[model samples]
Target: MSTTPLPLSALAAPIERGTAAYRRANFALFLAGCSTFSLLYCVQPLLPEFARDFGLAPAVSSLALSLTTAALALAIFIAGALSQQVSRRRLMFASMALAAACNLLAAIAPDWTSLLLARTIEGAMLGGVPAVAMAYLAEEMDPRHLSGAMGLYVAGTAFGGMMGRVGMGVLVEIGSWRSAMAAIGAFGLIAAIGFAALLPPSRRFAPRRGFVARHHLDAWRAHLAHPGLLRLFAIGFVLTSVFVALFNYVGFRLAGAPYDLGPAGISLIFLAYVFGMFSSPFGGRLADRFGGRAPLIGGIAIMTAGAVVTLAAWLPLIVLGICLITIGFFVAHSVASAWVGRLARADKGHASSLYLLFYYFGSSVTGVIGGWAWQHGGWSGEVALTASLALAGIVLAIRIEDPRQPDRSDA
Candidate 1:
């Protein structure tokens, strides 16, 4: 069932953004991105519904997602290692298809525990895509144009996240959360088929055909010891913690108070990801021209300001603040993600996996902790925690110097 890879020299040219090869690569990966994220986060808007139907606390309901992310974080480590023995394209397609099926199972589960179990397994199945995507791009694309491709891939994730949140919000108006989950699972199935059909075979990769733990361990150790890579990993943890925590509790905040937004109205808030779609590429371009440090710091600053602004009472102002935070998160993430490939001298798959491990770990930990803050201190408490995380990210960004660039600080 395996096709022999062509010589590396023949396929090593990085796909430029406008060429036909680039078009095919981006379209397939974009769909893959959309499917992966939509399935993963589709449960977010349904947290309140779970609380009402299952009589779970906010912190308990948060487990539905936290379990998925926590499992995904650990699974990514294993998946990244497994990918060395499996074809990248096959691994991603299988991941998407399996995760979609898991979503459908969750939709039909009769009890709360069953649904959580489904989500946890879904998270583990979904790990193959993100763990290997950046590595695929790092190996396949022209190194000079890598930022643009990564930006586009990230943009797809934003769109997928928006669809998951907004679509669930809108779909629930017609049916229950179960129906929403079923519908999104169907969409994921379709995207998975398209991804398998459109993606070209890997020319640069040769499957290792078996497990090799020592190699992965060495790479992980080397990356952890490198100061620049270490800082980037820390930044991933901090920024994602802030982003997920804000969105996790914001649903509860908007649903309860003077705003009293319904699910659909709360769903509209995720439309802020539209800003994220644009900011991802824009951040990547900035990184290409200037450096990762400036955009990274600027994004952290914007995220912090947005958190502070959300403390305001006005709904319009709060929405604006969310949009700013969304934009900042995507911008910072785009830079940091692409930087991983550039920074890793070798074992790019292991490097990319480590970055996402921290990223999702942040989501799982802060996401639940923020719910606790909500239970104890309300919106103000959530804002305080997010703001602090953002500030820490900024400080880390300031202190770390990019090895690829000179010591000068100009952005």
Candidate 2:
């Protein structure tokens, strides 16, 4: 066996911490992460407003966000394939700009149908961000800095998701929902501009000259063939299904109950996301100290307990439940997402895309179905659905053969 080491000149030098380029890259990704999520979910807290204004059922009103996520789930595959040919910064910049424009269009949408159409388009446009961002990081960042960068990026998404719902509620309370949408749309546009200006062009990425269907398909096939990857994908599906479904209906429940809440007051509940932001890093630590499985299952248990807590008639208990759910969701997602990267020795981009496909698919499908549960059976029905999904997540985590095999890459 040859004992000779390769020269540094032969390797691609990676972006490391404490550099101008590193700072710009992380901040750019933070903006991209924040803008994509905030715009995608800004409609969440306003489902009641849509129902009242449009004379639609809760299930129908939820299509504003649900349709967008569904379209995003489908478009992720296409975006993953497209990344081969497009420059990372340009593709992400275009996506951010287009999505912001679509959000503005939704703001001025004349009717429910028009709003849904605009939102779906916005979702499809956002396809360029999440998975692509992950792939870009894997390609550009030094391995030592990758974990820290990933955590910060995920934190941005958490912060944005919280602000989007809370800000929507506060804005709608001050003005109309349309004006609120416009304000958020403008925020997204600003973020896009900042992202494009700040992000360094990819130094390590090689742009494929043309698309190759067979090569990409084979990569995806290999990821799906792995048992651990499949389980993580299922966990992604359940984690989001339980979290988004419950949040989707909580606004409806609060809007019409013994404790009626206006948009602003209800938005305060979303501040629970602050707890989620903290929990994500903490979850990674726990996974490091004890392998991924313990924390993964424990997080789901927290979620299950949280779901059951909401069954109480007291408003404080319901809010507490929501907070627990948020914390658990981030914890589980942090572990599971990091695990996906470790599991895929090759085609990491395709693995990221497949995982997110299930993740947002859950958001789109169960987000609306939870509304059905809310309409037919009320809060208890929603709890029932979420609890079942949490249980499924537990079972999936149990079946994973070796969660401890994951490396230092913790999201």
Q: How far is candidate 2 from the true structure (C-alpha RMSD, Å)?
A: 4.6
Enumerate residue pairs that collide in model 2: none
How would you encode candidate 2's per-residue C-alpha lDDT over 1-411 as one tens digit per residue? Answer: 112223324557888768898899988988998899899889987798999999999879988987888788888888887886778899999999999999999999999999999999999999999988877776677654554566557667898898788878879879999999999899999999999999999776666666778878987998899999999999999999999899867877888868888766767878998988778767756665566788889999999999999999899998999989998988888777766765666566788899999998887678779989998988899999999999999999999876344444433
Residue by residue across 1-411, what tens digits does model 1's lDDT show? 333335557655656656887778888888988898899989988998999999999779978887897788888888877887788999999999999999999999999999999999999999999878888887787665666677778998999999988888888989999999999999999999999998888777877645657776887999999888888899999989999899877877888879898767877888999999899889877876676789999988999999989999999999989999999999999888888888886777888899999998787789779989989988899989999888889888888777665323322
TM-score of each: 0.90, 0.85
Worst 10 residues of 1 by lDDT: 402-411
